[model samples]
Target: MSEMLEVKEQETLSETVPVFGYELIREVLLPDILGEETPKILYWAGKNLARKYPLKSASEIITFFKQAGWGDLRVVKESKNEQILELSSEMIVNRMKTNGKTTFQLEAGFLAQQYEGQKQVITEAFEHPKKRSAKVQFTIKWDMKDFA
Candidate 1:
């Protein structure tokens, strides 16, 4: 009975396997393959993802980011034409701490595309990475005249 219980427990534990070596693909391999266009490609891919998800509100967007393992997304500020968001995560910190000049254009572009779809406008996003703080701030802006 004791051996059977141990086997069951081990099986349960083994069901929850953790993924490893993602950084090698995301940080190194993709960049090496994409080179100068890595940022652009990532940004567009993020936008494409947003289009598929099509969230309704800012809170939903934040939740999506968390669920997608992107990071903690918070609203720093909001205005008639712009919204500022701060993103931070373990991966983000590790990248910033080790790789001085890394970019999170994917997150920025995702926000931009989500906002654009929601507001029915042409939106653009810019990323500002703070290495010391190990966070990325995204500023998403839209023009009222450019309707989608």
Candidate 2:
């Protein structure tokens, strides 16, 4: 009985929302409500969300991105003060094809805050969407001199 319950819990945790529903809210409704400021607002919103769901390691952040249906996140490069992460998915490809101006500011901000929490330093992230490649690259940089 306990084994079955555990399986059920795992299944529930892994359940995902349909892509159409997600796109409707994220692309349509949000833009309609927030207008030109949508991208900026989403970036800050992602930071707040990171604060609410803090994770200890890069692996945990990667897992969280998958669980949240954002995309498959992987570290492309890492240095002392900077890290490059790439996110790719079929959904991301679709979004890029459908909307040329699609922004990944939310994901960028999430990464920035997560790294800030991990390194205890002030961090910022920039999103570069590769429309041709159908991927988004995030460059996260931390100021070692500025402690958070």
Candidate 3:
């Protein structure tokens, strides 16, 4: 809803998300634009999301949901400290995966389908009765353990 894009990454938690003017566009936004092929698109979206926000820890990513108007994002798995994000939205899920059909619908739908099996999809959504948005729930997982 806002034109100004405020993006930053934090290994350590920093920057608080403001309420309103934010929409859950990750899952819905990426897929429609890049269809048939989902890997490249998902990768870019994940990287971009990681870069845009200072999601240092798994919990922080969850908190981003409430701030971004998305649902309750959570982490259900941990591979030696590496957490995975699961995003879902009933409203957005039922929508088509075609590009440019509807900005929010397309974006939310794309994000949901693209991350399926490829990574941990942690996000959910609810159709706004009056507003032109939905509540998406998802988690963002990162590789915390590195091998040498």
Whichever of 1 and 2 has more lDDT, that candidate is 2
Candidate 3 regions exceeding 4 Å error are 1-35, 81-85, 96-148
Q: What CA root-mean-square deviation does each model show from the true structure? A: 8.6, 4.3, 10.5
What tens digits encode model 1's per-residue C-alpha lDDT throughout 1-148?
1344345446666454232365677788889999989999999988997887777888888877865667899999999999889998988898887766577888888899999988999999999998888889999999999998
lDDT of candidate 1 at residue 143, scale 0 to 100? 92
lDDT of 1: 0.82
> Pairs clashing in candidate 2?
none
- Sort the candidates on TM-score, descending order: 2, 1, 3
lDDT of 2 by residue, 54-129 (tens): 8788988897788678999999999989999999999999999887768888898899999999999999999999
Q: Residue 78's C-alpha lDDT in candidate 1?
A: 91
Instruction: List, residue by residue over 1-148, the lDDT tens digit for candidate 3.
Output: 1112223223214655432112234434444566745545444455455444433344554555544434545554546423344444543343323222433332333333333323444432211221233333333233323211
TM-score of 2: 0.91
By lDDT rank, best first, the candidates go 2, 1, 3
lDDT of 2 at 128: 91
